[model samples]
Target: MDPSEVEFLGEKQLVSIVPNFSFGIIHLISGSVGPFRAGLPVKVPIWLAISLKQQQKCRIIAQEWMDIEKLNDSIEAEKRSKLFTKMPSNHFMDEAQMLLMVAPDDIPDADNIRTAVKDIWDLRMSKLRSSVIGFVKNAGTYAKLDHLTAMEINSIRSLLPDALDIMLHMEHGGKPTVLQSLNTTM
Candidate 1:
């Protein structure tokens, strides 16, 4: 899947916002938003929160897991763990990117949080690459991807399948068998 597609999924995650204006609950296909009152926090999808933030109608309350201290700890844990560690959110990277981009002013220590998140991502990606290499070398049919986040999995979506197909072809002595079809019948 494309990064944009992953981001679209991430946009569905709920976030807190303190709207400056009052409004009744806005119904959406996903669910009802809220009867937003001035200066009161309400949970809404990231997409709507971003929209409201862009329009200067509300201040986005950063996700609880977005705290700099928490992020730093997560980075340390990821560095120490050999296997993929559980992330605060399934779409943590995308959510952080969107929230930081839209409302950096509202989130405390935005720069530090960004750096910490990047560190964690880099560490995880490095580990994932090493694991993939080992898996391919061992000719393993299955892998346990317990704690890998959506973005991480999507990153390898294209490469892994193609690599496996190549391995299969090699195993079959590179013959064009029934599994391999020609472009078109002449």
Candidate 2:
């Protein structure tokens, strides 16, 4: 059969077909969410279906690599070290198990998984910034803004604009008071 004449099923779960081997081609497609089972009839070309499946797999692998690279660049090594110490290997294993606890019959959606990952990434970034600011403020012993060095003052100033921007973007008022409080406390 010519490759171009093949048809495939792109379902997330195992695809069921009568007389499975009767098809000219069969391909297993894996994505971030789950795997898909595809089959081509004798009349369809096998090569075309296989090529499409391979393309899909390549795209998924590329996306995963990009995500991992982004995560590695964004997270600080010190923070990661602290996280690893707090969570421990057993905790990571438990979390991994929980993540993969879905039933065999249930196939997760790729788009949904991508969206979830994006949301979690955003949340973590926000938390990281907040914690860093908190740590700096807590560690400084300066009693007044005048007592702070130029670099320290600049750092605090930089954080204030971003914090205010976030508050404004969220439509939360009282940004001035928050800034004043942070200035006096730090």
Candidate 3:
């Protein structure tokens, strides 16, 4: 699966809404949603919220952690913590991007939200890059690392095959293919 898809597997889709009219409970396999009423906020899934919004039945209320500052802080905290820290939602950034596009009024700091997501992604990518370098340097002596986050593993997965190939070639006394190509045509 795509790294982002894997990352968002545990996404929480809860959203708050103010419906335009009274309604009965929405039955689902997971659970029931709501007996929606106009002018009163009721928590529902993003899918339902979007449907209501599109139909002009409700206005969306964004989550508390939807702010840019909060997201940046969360990213920093995750970096500092030795263990994984739970984010507000697994797919917050992706979900927020869609929400902002479809309902910009619901999110107050739309610009900052975009910036925050980009910053967090960049920070994680930098960390991933460093970790991969460290992993490569420690290859022969490598044992198990029990602390890597799912993001880190996902970031490194694509590079692993090539790295293993290089290690195997070196162990069998072959120079790196790239070095050999330095003197070759095409």
Per-candidate local distance difference test: 0.92, 0.33, 0.70
lDDT of 3 by residue, 4-101 (tens): 56535423378787787998898988789888877889998777677778988888887778776788897788679644456566565566665676
Q: What is candidate 2's lDDT per residue for 9-102, written digit by digit as tens?
A: 2111122121222222345354221133233212222223233334442111112222433334434442444321221111222122222232
If ranked by lDDT, best first, what sequence of candidates would result? 1, 3, 2
On TM-score, the leading prediction is: 1
Answer with 1 or 2, whichever has the higher TM-score.
1
Query: Which pairs clash inside model 1?
Result: none
Residue 37 of model 1, lDDT score:
98
TM-score of each predicted structure versus truth: 0.95, 0.23, 0.67
Instruction: In angstroms, give how far residue 172 of model 3 lies from its true place.
Output: 10
Candidates 1 and 3: which is better by TM-score?
1
Question: Which portions of model 1 miss their true places by more than 4 Å?
Answer: 177-180
TM-score of 1: 0.95
For model 3, the local distance difference test gives 0.70
Q: Against the hidden true structure, what lDDT does model 1 obtain?
A: 0.92
